[model samples]
Target: MVSFGDSKFVKKVCGITQASYQHGWDERNGGNVSLRLTAEDLVGFDDVSEVKRTLDLGFDAKVLSGSYFLVTATGRYFRNVISQPGLDLGLVKITDDGQHADLLWGYEDGAKPTSEFPSHLMSHIKRLKVDPEQRVVMHCHPTNVIALSFTHELDERSITRLLWKMQAESLVVFPEGVGIIPYMTPGTNEIGKATSDKMSEFRTVIWPHHGIFGTGDDLDEAFGLIETVEKAAAIYSQICAQGGEIRQEITDEQLGDLAHAFGVVASPKFLS
Candidate 1:
C-alpha cells in the first residue's frame, strides 16, 4: 500500500500516465514509469503469499517501502490507465507500514498496476537523494529515440554531451545531463541500478536496445522534456542517414550564452 500526502497529486499522476499511453509514445509493456509522492510510502502486496513469491523471485525485502509510487500494473494496457483525458484517475493509499493498499476511487476492477513497480520504487529512493522534489518519473520507447540509441555505442556521458550540443538547458537544467544506461534485462534489479544512476544526473536516459526514462518537477514538464530529446535525436538520425554530418558543434561558452538568452539553459546549436 502506498500513502499520499496529497490526493490530487495522485490523480494528476494517473491522468498523465494515461495520456502518455494514448499518445503512442508508451508501447504496451515496453516500459514503465513512476512518480515519487511521499518518499516513504509502504509497498503493497496482494497477501503474504505475494510477498513470499516476490522474495522467491529474488527481490530484496527493503524495497517494499517508499512514500508512494505510481507504477504500471503487470501486463496491463496503457490505454486502460487508471485515469482518462479529463478524469480523476482515482487514488490508492497505504500507510507507512504495509498494512493495506486501498484504491480510493476512479479505477475499475481488473485494472492492475505495471510490473515495473519494483524498479520504480527503487529508482525513487536513489534519485531523491539528488533532487528531493522531482515527482514524475516516466519510461517510454519512442521510435526515434530507440533508433538513435541502437545505432550508436554511447556511454551516458557521451549522450549528455550530444544532447548539450543540441540543447543545453536540458543538459544542466535538471542538474546534470542525460544518462545512457547499458542495456539490461527489464524488470530486474540490474536495471534498477542503472535507472537510479541516470535519474540522478539528468531528467532523462536512453536505454540501449530498450527505451528511455525521464523525470521532472511535474508530469507535463517531464513528458515535454522526453518529447524534446526524442525530437532532437530523431533529427540527428535523419541527418546521419542522409550521409550528412552535424553541420556545426557549439562550444560550451556558446551553449551557456544560449541558455541565458532563452531564460533557460539549452543546447547552443539548432537546425541552423
Candidate 2:
C-alpha cells in the first residue's frame, strides 16, 4: 500500500533536492539526482507493474539493462520536490536494450527524466564497475564550488591538493582525489563519457565552471562527498574575500600524517 510519495527513496531524494535548493546549490532546474534502486526498495510500490511511458536514453545503458532508478524529472525545480514528489520525480526501469527506459511511476504530468540523465547513467555505469555496492549519483551546482572552479586551476591534482589543504579531513574523505573535466555542453553523451572516464578512479568529479558529480554506496555518502568538497570551496572563497592572507595552511607532510591517521591512502598522484 505504499504510495509513490510515501516511499523512503522518494522522500530521501526529494528532501535532498530541497536541501540543495535551500542551500542555494540548485537554482531552477540546474541540478539533478539519480539513485539506483533494488527490488527490495520497490517492494511496496503497487503501481510499478507496467510502463507508464518510454523515453530514449540517447546512449548505450546496456550495462544497466533491467536496472531501476528513482530520478528527478526534466525541467523540474528542486524547491518543489518535497512539496510535490509525484510531479517532480519518476521511477524508471532501463529497457532490455538499454537504449530506453520505461517509466513506472511519478512524473504525473508526463515529464521525462532530467536532460542530464545520460550523464547520470554514464557515471552510474562507471562507478558501479569501480565499486559494485555504489548506488547513488548526484550532481549539483554549489556556488562556492563553481566559484573555486573559476578562481582555481582546472587541473585535478591542483584542485585536489588545494581542497585537501583547506581542510584536515578533505584527504581522508576523498583519498583518491577529485577529477576535473573540460567544460562542455551538459546533458550530452560527450560530457557523460568524459565524466565516466574520470569516475574510473575518483568518486568525485568536478565540472569546471559548472558543478560537481559525486558517487557513493548510498544517498548520504554521495551527498556527503559533494558536501565536504563544497565546504572546502566555501572556506577557500572566504579566505580570498578576506585579503588572501594565509598565516598558515596544512602542509603535505601533515596531510600524509592525517591520511595515515584516518587509514585512507591519499592519492600519490595528487600528493607531493
Candidate 3:
C-alpha cells in the first residue's frame, strides 16, 4: 500500500496550504483546513482501520459520527506543509459515539489535529444539513478581510454589498452573499457555534477582527470562496488607502444584472 503521505488528498492539502501561506494569508500557523473524506476515498490504504491514536473531542459531535476527515495539524506552519505533509497533516475518523477520533494516518510525529477541529466539524455539520455535498472548511486570517472588518460595518448586508460592488466576480461567485459574526475567541466551541450558525445561511462567514470561514464541496472551492472575498476586500482597502473618493462603483442594479447573467440568485438580504 502506498503511504498516506503520497496520497492525492495530502498532496492537495500541501498545495493549497502552501498557496494560502504564500498569498500572505496564513502566516505562522494562522490557518487550518479540513476536508471530509468518504470511505471510498480510504479504500486503497493498508491499515486504514488501524488507530494510531485516539483523541478526545471535548464536545459532542454526534452528527459527525462515523465520518472521516483529512486535517492540518495544530501549530503546524502552512509554509512547511508542502515539505512535511506527513507530520503536518492527519487522517482521522470520528468515533461511532462522536466524542472522540481515531487517528488513521499521517501526524507521523504524534501531533494532534488543529485546535480548530471542533469548529471545522461544527461547520461541516451545519453546512452538510443545507448542502449535502459540502466537504471542506477552511479558516484563514487574510489581511485584507480582517482590515475590512475593522473599517467596515459588521453587518452582513453592509459587508456583502461592499464586497459585491468592488468586483463583479464577487457578485457572481457568492450571489447568496456572506455572513458576519461578532469577534469571538478562536478555537473555542462558542466561536465554532456562531460560525456554523451563519454557515447554515451562507458559504462564507467573516469573524470580525479575526478571520474568515469558508465552506465548499472541495478544497479548491472553499479556498476560492475565501480568496474571492479577500480580493474584493483588498480593492476596497486600496481605495481607502488612496483617500477613499468613489467617483463610481458597481451599482446594486449592475450587481443584480451580473447575477442574472451568471444564472445566480442575488440574496435579497444584500441586494434588495
Q: 228 in model 2: Cα distance from truth in Å?
A: 0.7
Cα-lDDT of candidate 3: 0.91
Model 1 RMSD, rounded to 1 decimal: 6.6
Each prediction's Cα lDDT score?
0.58, 0.90, 0.91
Cα RMSD (angstroms) for every candidate in the order listed: 6.6, 1.0, 0.9
lDDT of 2: 0.90
Report the lDDT tens digits of candidate 2 across residue range 88-196: 8999999999999999999989899999999999999988887889999999998999998887779888989989999997898899999999999888889999999
Query: Which regions in candidate 3 have their CA more than 4 angstroms from the true location?
Result: none
Better of 1 and 2 by lDDT: 2
Model 2 quality (TM-score) = 0.98
Best by TM-score: 3
lDDT for 128 (candidate 2): 87
lDDT of 3 by residue, 1-272 (tens): 66667789999999999999989989898999999999999887775678999999887988888999999999989999999988999999999888999999889898999999999999999999998999999999999999988887788888888999998899888988999888888989999999888888999999999899999999999999999999999999999999999899998779878988989999998887
Error of 1 at 182 (Å): 1.3
